[model samples]
Target: MTLPFFVYGTLRPGETNHDRFLRGRTSSEEPGRLTGSVLYDGPGYPYAVDEPGGVVHGELVTARPGDYRELLAVLDRLEEYAPGDARNLYERVERGVVRARDGLVMQAWVYVAAPPAAARLRAGGRRIEGGDWRIRS
Candidate 1:
């Protein structure tokens, strides 16, 4: 069975790494919201660090398990996955995702940065009202 994933960073569609890894393989992607998480941008990329009153803006993708593994490897190589003591950029985590229509809760994979690492880039905090992250002019 395929797994559902919540992508908040580069892996999201229209982002840099999307075409290479998730373009054709992704089954479906739609706006999804995960609460109680923070976003911090380090030297290289942004990370969704866990915190209170924090919500991450990202997409929900359903893909094969192998595809998720492949995607993890890519994130690791790019220093985006920091699971265990691997020193990766983003740490693989399981979080609750809220679908748009029915407001149902689903278990999904998410990547968050380690606390120590995130502290270095924590300027202040970011907040997205009503689940949106598009940079506005």
Candidate 2:
């Protein structure tokens, strides 16, 4: 089955990793938002964690069925997510994403900071109140 992924960091379009990873592989892409999440600066990258009143701006990408498995593997490695690993940096989960251009809502895979990782980032990482990693202030 084709899978949609919500990316809020380097993986987003025009970002450093976009060309290397998603550029021509995705079948469709659109601006989207995930509610109840906050974006944080993870030094060179950004991380997203659950926050009751937060909204994270990102993009929703649809991967063709032929590319789904390989695409996910690459993303997993980039995010340092290892299945069954207790110390994973991010935990991949399915969540609802709202397309920014329209009101359409769809379930997509999202990588969120794990509990311990989130706590650490909350204590040290700078929070991007606007929830957009592309914006710099």
Candidate 3:
């Protein structure tokens, strides 16, 4: 089965990690938004956290069945997420993503900061008010 992924940071098209991981592996892609989340600068990267009135601009990508597992594995490694690992940098979870063009909403995998991580990022990371990583200040 194909799987959808909501990517707000490096994995979006034209971003550094996109070509490395998803260039030709995805079946489709479109601009998308993740509501109720905030984006924060993580220096070279960015991180998203759950918030009440936040919206993060991103892209939704569909990975073919044959590429799903491998793609997920690579993403997991890149995000430093190992199932059940206490030190994981990000927690991958399924969340709703709204397509920018048509307003179509769908569930997709998203990486979010855990509570502690969120707190730390909030304390030190610059909030990207527009929620687009490419427009970082």
lDDT of 1 by residue, 46-106 (tens): 6776678877778888875457667556655665454477565556777898877678888
Residue-by-residue lDDT tens digits, candidate 3, 37-126: 999988688999988899999999999758889999989999998878888779998998998888988999999987778999888878
Give lDDT per model, in order. Answer: 0.68, 0.90, 0.89
* Residue 117 lDDT (model 3): 88
Cα lDDT of model 1 overall? Answer: 0.68
Error of 3 at 45 (Å): 0.5
Q: Each model's number of backbone clashes?
A: 3, 0, 0
Ranking by lDDT: 2, 3, 1
TM-score of 2: 0.94
Q: TM-score of every model?
A: 0.77, 0.94, 0.94
Indicate the worst ten consecutive residues by lDDT in candidate 3: 1-10
Candidate 3 C-alpha error for residue 93, in Å: 0.5
True-vs-predicted CA distance for residue 38, candidate 1, Å = 2.0
Model 1 spans with C-alpha error above 4 angstroms: 64-68, 79-82, 123-133
Candidate 2 weakest ten by summed lDDT:
1-10
